[model samples]
Target chain A: MLPFARVTVIGLGLIGSSILRATRSAMPTVRLTGYDVDPEVRGIADRIGLADDIADSAGAAVIDADLVILCVPVGAMGAVAAALADDLPADAIVSDVGGSKESVIAALRSALPEATIVPGHPVAGTEFSGPEAGFATLFRGRWCILTPDDATPEAATVRVRDFWEKLGANVETMTARHHDLVLAVTSHVPHLIAYSIVGTASDLEDVTQSEVIKYSAGGFRDFTRIAASDPTMWRDVFLNNREAVLEILQRLTEDVTMLQRAIRWGDGDALLDLFTRTRAIRRSIVEQGQDDAAPDFGRAHE
Target chain B: MLPFARVTVIGLGLIGSSILRATRSAMPTVRLTGYDVDPEVRGIADRIGLADDIADSAGAAVIDADLVILCVPVGAMGAVAAALADDLPADAIVSDVGGSKESVIAALRSALPEATIVPGHPVAGTEFSGPEAGFATLFRGRWCILTPDDATPEAATVRVRDFWEKLGANVETMTARHHDLVLAVTSHVPHLIAYSIVGTASDLEDVTQSEVIKYSAGGFRDFTRIAASDPTMWRDVFLNNREAVLEILQRLTEDVTMLQRAIRWGDGDALLDLFTRTRAIRRSIVEQGQDDAAPDFGRAHE
Candidate 1:
């Protein structure tokens, strides 16, 4: 393990708190400082001992730290970076766990010009948010994708990649643009569609509304879990990653319309072909160990 | 429990096998007969002791039975009903488990003119299909909706309702049109969207296509589970429930576009409000015991 020396993490949401917990577990000797605007979350982090020190301000957290990780929503990256820009020691390896890469890199680069910023995204989280929801094993066996276009120093990228490796995440590097496009299809557009479907179900006539909830098992339950994600965070992800999301949405709309036509025309072969092809990807995800077999039926056990 | 003198089930898919298993456990005295176009499926059902008898054809199954249940694809309801119409014993309570109610009712009513048709749907199933995928408790504590019209005989409807209740299901009655419309939003559209999203992800350029599956937990995994459902069955559902699904899809598309615009404008409030409302519905579904928490993620472990 290449010693992180002193590491600072900003924000204590699901991703932020998870990073703090994982870092503490993996590197007990490394000094860790955490800062979150939410005082209750900060206290939870302290009580749980996720960080060795709790910093009152961003500057207090970044000063003399060898590495700084922006674990906030993509929308807040710029402001957080600007706050700690002057306090960040020169050559501090800066990285992030933001969902969207392009906007984060652009925002952080404008603020922390002196720091070597290596944009990263840990493709892991639960519906729950804040410090209490975090666990040390959140990133275990998951992927932590890093996107560092031309300007990022190779040494800084390597350090951030190594840090992710210690947290039990497989590390891979890609271009910021590619990351944005891929995530738009994988995460952003899917989230938007989920939010939309759930919203539609919620608006049904009162009697049907209850039945919608009652019979959600048919398929609607899955969308609700995706829709349950922190609204502000998802909103920021979509806003920061607008063009890519819209592009993917356009493609999705075309595909949906085509499926609709197949249904209208009673083309079972077309429908079966499309549906069958999608199942292979699910098998791949299962083989890759991204999902488990026990489906949470959205109920508390009796 | 009211005795089922003789119960006939057509099509030995997941829902059919499940109802058969449930019936066997609930009413051991009831003589159960099953028929499917695929003789292999019937052989499996017989081998697994899922039914007391296996019929060679739909006509052979319904003859002399007190209750005949059409459990084929939604699109196949008419053909199955027509085939058995002449052979169905007089005064027999004919019901179906088609995902779409309106079409099922209309087709059965037109075909089985002399029979008491009480259309129904058990709002429960798994991604896996076939007789081997079923369990005796598949319908236990789940909603079994009956959509019989005003003209249907009360005794027939009550008998159908009682059958589901004996199998440990909570039975409710509503208009077939209403059931179709509500399910359009809650089930049909969601399945279509999930299938479309998975299809889009699969079509992505090779490198990204693989990563999308690898990192599916970030929300795409849920879509995959829904998309991975039996293609033939879903294709039939869409074709048979075309009008209601299309109507809901149009509304969903408009709602999705609005959310897309909100994301573009960085309207966190709009996104947050919708997200919060959708979360409440999911909670309500859990409270009603219709869904499980993190259901998609748990499928991996199962």
Candidate 2:
């Protein structure tokens, strides 16, 4: 049986639009509705027939949805949830696709206290945003983390889990607090470092911007891809997951300082030791099927 | 006419084997020879027929070559060059594929004063190393920067440039000092940061290594791909390009500090501005053909 007969997705950006497409492809009989804060996105969704119905307003979209997912940024989850609170079906299960779980769970629960809230984060995305950048296969073989507290109903969590599994995600259950910390190290801090390094490269007086762009294949190109992620979404992630991100950043900075001192003192062994250890982690990641085993992350060469 | 009819590669690693393969494909009639200090690598290269002849020693490899490209780590370039100095052909042009040019040029010139020295760095590589991991297309459409000082012969410089072009690389000339500085920003520091972050992630007491590997798709996988690079090569790069790399690291640290404060104070505006600016740089890199326009760097998903 399908997890939800009527599903509504708010915020028709990459993740939300991808959900619509994936749901349609996987369970065609299920009804779908979509809405976006941006009118232009809504118009595009309508033109492309992204859903069974393109709701003009948030309230209209979730009026009858058995499952209403807040696909908006973490900071905007409260406002988006509150907008549809009165219109949402009495038996609906509310979920979200936020990078950080604690803040989202808090915001979502506060907005809809009577709702069955089961927050999730699908650990998948590209460097692109907007409705047109998503595809049905985006979630295939990726992890979808469900951060449901003890108070959450078992049936509600199971339905949410099944829905993500139908969309080709490997679902795992965890606490909201742990999810935030794990994601902080794995996603948020990595992105912050990428953005900081890219900015550092661009601001250099010694190196021309053209030179940086031309020679990016050396390694800088990888940072640019992550840094190119949606600004508003990432800003919300940092703001909401502040403590965890700051703690991870502090750890990263200490490591960087140690390496910096090693470089200054010409300590080749210390550098090599760390470099060697990191290589093993890459192997573990590839072996776990989290990434491809192809060289250079399987970057296409033309 | 080919740039060099008889070319010897003195290091049967990724870059050397790739040069041999690309040379065989592009100029089938040219004679190629290869050598490595490790007998096991030599045995593998011989078993795979990586070159027409796998010399037993570095001195034997360059005996009759018109051009010899040293593909050893920067730290070993001096020793490799010294080993071949007496056996090198009187008119042979010596070159290298080192990440940093200045130290390599100095080492080669000091070791073989009378030899025609032209150092080049192909701004291309995958995390995989060794002869068997290489492919002929690694250098296709990639930039090869040649560092030939004023004292180097014009004929020698042109011949080296033409050789790289025949191997499907776009060649450019620059001073060795400037090349070191630019690469310090683009390649060296990026690698250092990647290594540092990966090290930090692995060392976290609260997060298990398995957790880091499983959730790597969140963004940590990108850094791992770079941190998995050859330790010896990267060690040599950091040690030899000390000044420039340290300078860039200092700049990157300052930028990270600024962003840290922004996140701590909940300054979303500052964070958004930097994230937005970085996206433009990614677009520029893609437009300039330095990286593919495909989302997520066109990483193979399966």
Q: What DockQ does predicted model 2 obtain?
A: 0.81
TM-score of each: 0.94, 0.99
Pick by DockQ: which candidate is best? 2
Per-residue CA lDDT of model 1 for A73-152, tens digit only, reads 88999999998887888868888999998888889888877678889998888777788777788888888899988898
lDDT of 1 by residue, B1-302 (tens): 56468999998888899888888888888999999999899888888887888988889988889998888888888898899888888868888899998878888888877778889999888777788877788888788899988778887888888899999888989888888887887788888999999988877663367879767767788788878788988988888888999988888888888987886777878887887777787778767777655533333221
Candidate 2's displacement at residue B17, Å, is: 0.5
Off by over 4 Å in 2: none
TM-score of 2: 0.99
Clashes of each: 26, 0
lDDT of candidate 2 at residue B86, scale 0 to 100: 93
Error of 1 at A104 (Å): 0.7
Residue A197 in candidate 1 has what lDDT?
87
lDDT of 2 by residue, A1-302 (tens): 99999999999999999999999999999999999989999999999999999999999999999999889989999999999988988899999999988888888888899999999999999999999988998998889999989779999999999999999999999888888889998999999999999999999988999999989989999889999999999999999999999999999999999999999999999999999999999999988888878887676655
